[model samples]
Target: MPSDYHHGVRVIEILDGVRPIRTVETGVVGVVGTAPDADPEVFPLDEAVLIIGSRTKAAKLDTTGNGQGTLPGVMDAIFDQIAPLIVVVRVEDVEDENEQISKILGTVDATGHHSGLQALLTAKTSLGIKPRILGAPGFSHHQPVADELGIKAEHLRAFAYVDSPATTVEEAVVHRNLFGNKRVMIMWPAFKVWDTPLADYVYQPASARALGMRAKLDNDIGWHKTISNIVINGVSGLTADVSWELQNPVTDAGYLNANEITTMVVQDGFRFWGSRTCSGDPMFAFESAVRTGDVLADTIGEAHMWAVDKPMSPTLIQNIMDGVNSKFRELKNFSYIVNAECYLDPELNSVESLASGKLWLNYDYSPVPPLEQLGFRAKLTNKYLVELLEVK
Candidate 1:
């Protein structure tokens, strides 16, 4: 049947133009450690990688009898503080430190199969998700793993949380100075945390706790804030409390802070008391600055993926510049940056270069630096009454 429609009816429509940039997920942690159920026959050790969303999922995969090389503790420590997604890469458990290191850095077999760290790297590539933070809490105080993870982080444009094999402040500072890289941050002195299933306090790496704290900071606030002076949850006490005042000089804490090695101290409760990267370059020494720069770079890179292989016209270039400048202005409005400038010049985008299908973009910005030092000044005055009476 046919019917006549009502006259003078109005219809409204909306259109979306110029796609905005997408914000990348921050503080996703990638953990490589040992798990009993990660056997070759059960979970295919060569390709053993899982994304755990909650503590319950982690408990199911933790088949270790004594809860060693298990993910429940780390998961509990992380999820108890902040809710961030985690990727778990399980490697075979070995007693010998050298053998474990060897396994993590896998070698190609006759059948062209890789194991251990190599396998995890392969899985990471295949999964197509890059975690912004990396940690390996199961391998306590293992420097080799930290080194390899630092290399991976440099390639992946991420950050790593490394644990120093030192129990005292002096030893930790010495150990931290051995490696100088911007992508890694060193933590010291394992802490004892109560385990419900074990009914006892077990010492665990401080890197796990640091990772959780960073995650919480990212969730609660922006990445421009430092992770220092924040209380660490899920821990009772440090294995050895390193005092900043008892050192050779009272200023040794400043030295430790300069070296990028953070320590646990007793305040009202245990707290993380430093924020710096292991980079020798003083420009990027602060961990918060490094993270903010990374976030900016990643966001810009992902946002420009749509312009690839497009026509190299002036309109196209202007569109790209406008999009980038818009994002930076938003950051400035949010107080993440002092100001940002982006442009392309003839020197960078020459006629020959443009003809050869090449384009260049240059941007500069300053991040909000953390207040590592605070000072207060006071002056004594004797004529307070006379000064007050003369104001009118």
Candidate 2:
């Protein structure tokens, strides 16, 4: 908007300096599953549907037919903790479990049509907000289903909460070996909840509460906090009793956590007992760390449209750096990160690259990993005894 053609000299205010970087919203849960009793008009098959916490809207997914559908049950679990914006992708439910899983995994046709979990890819466009926590509660225990969750999570830059087929600690460890991806969370030993229609106690997958609790954590605390040690709701008890002692690694809960499997333990109440991702790398060992990195990257990627196609001026470069560093500083002040810095590397921003309209900005950060363990060295010393006597 240069007004240079005017005869009268008009001062055009030039906006300069730090541009605000808007962060992508977190805590939105995206899920793919089947719902036999769900209303077609409300939740059509192979489509992404947005469902807020309206009982009337949620009641459309009725369970009067053949049991409560996977989506209904999963949503119930999530609602127990906190109301969240959920994107649901309902697939065709059939008698054959394998065939149903195939539908859940979905397909991308030559026509660019997406089905099943693939529908999640279109959520941001259709629903206006993408899901940050991904899962398929009843079916995610299968290897193919969990693998699909992983693929969708990486594409969406989200976290995958998966249930393990393992009913015991050792078996859960076997399932843990199957995954090394940082975004994948391994949960075991489904919790038991009351089934109103069936009039009995039914075991719900670990994903039932994991997804809800993650949303609560992202909302209550920052994305850097791990989803462990939080009291779980809407569950009577765990299907199996996993032992726990604060300092006892020999306990089943301790053993499971050591192998990167998250399970429910009966403490003050039923609480999640682990803070690990199924990552072999030490850097991304914790789920909180991986999420911190993802949230930061996604937020930065979605922001900065105004900077695009602008001339490669020193002022533009400084503006970009200042904006990003502003977000980093905010995250640090909120305790999401220990510390961070954004800088343009001179070596990476070479003359050839800048001439070609390519710029590389590097940001280094340390995510606040949860305190998984703490220890103290103790010794029977005469010095401590003397101090106690003198103090008395």
Candidate 3:
């Protein structure tokens, strides 16, 4: 959703689309020097916990040359109205500068104030209030500030509204607590493979080793012979017998870049979406293809593609290949293209993307340290090269 937290209230409302529904009752507490003419009680205070910081010293907002008393008394009325979820947002006036001015005016320059609210909300959350803090522009800092305030970052979902900006803390609380039950799930696949007594920690699986070996042998002979043969035959002309040096085993987190995956597939005559790349789940490939054209349906949710990061036995690889192929058959015209970089140990001589010939296996790369920092040698011999390509 587009957000306008950087600007004024009117801009916030204009940019932030519809108003979210406030399902939780929370006391909106804050110390603001200035307040809008509208009463806070008239706002959404019924089920909310409301607390106002009384200014013993005439609030700066009230003493300005053209100032009309806007806050203190209004706070009294708001406190009397709707009882709500309780938390405190303390406002302390720093020196009289633009910083102080913005703070007094509720212009989003209040990190401390926001932090205070996050703390208060967090306390409420601890008590099971599930408080959500919504803030404009500067308030987005709430994420880290909340952390500093000993509050859980996820507990306070921050948002920006450019148009019809929240006039008071109460309004801000309303927007924050109301983001529909819209939750986003981000997925990534772990694609690492190892062999022999679990040689690679990142991709360790005795089962995978057994499975991969079986699959490799079966593939070499004939399982999914049609596709395998086609792929082998088509690229056989470009195959080379050159020995290439492979290096740098990938760590647990490091993997191929998203763009690299897309390019690899497109080059292999497959179409894919950058956003559709799933990390560990192969089913997402089919789901991504199905939702390709449906805008609403395609709003990806709880779906992704990922690589299993264990030493794959030939049988495991075969299972993966078969599973994907079956889904591809159902989807029709779908070609499997993994967007992540294939992992190779440093002991492996080299990777060759040949234009023709048989895939020659020479050196075993499993024995070398996977860490790139251990000082691995780089080889220029070209078996296969990574190329930058356009996303289809």
Among these predictions, the greatest TM-score belongs to 2
lDDT by residue (1-392, candidate 1, tens digit) is 12456567656563223558876777677777766653344344546355545655666556554566645577778876776767666677788989987766566689867575545455456666666777777663677777877886776677888888876778888888778889888887788899876899988888887777887887788777777888888889878856664333345455667667877777677878788889989888888778878888999998987888877777788888888889988988988777887898778877888889999999988988888777678889786867767865
- Order the candidate numbers by lDDT, best to worst: 2, 1, 3
TM-score of each: 0.87, 0.95, 0.20
Segments of candidate 2 deviating more than 4 angstroms: 1-6, 63-67, 381-392
Candidate 3: stretches off by over 4 Å: 1-81, 95-97, 101-121, 125-130, 133-155, 158-392
lDDT (Cα, tens digit) per residue for candidate 3, span 34-66: 322224432211122333333322232233333
Q: What are the per-residue Cα lDDT tens digits for candidate 2 across 260-301?
A: 998888878889988999888999999888998998898888
Model 1 superposed RMSD (Cα): 6.0
> How good is model 1 by TM-score?
0.87
Look at candidate 3 and tell me the lDDT of residue 60: 28
Worst 10 residues of 2 by lDDT: 59-68
Spell out the clash pairs found in candidate 1.
Answer: none
Using lDDT as the measure, name the better of candidate 1 and candidate 3.
Answer: 1
Off by over 4 Å in 1: 1-17, 37-52, 107-115, 119-125, 244-252, 385-392
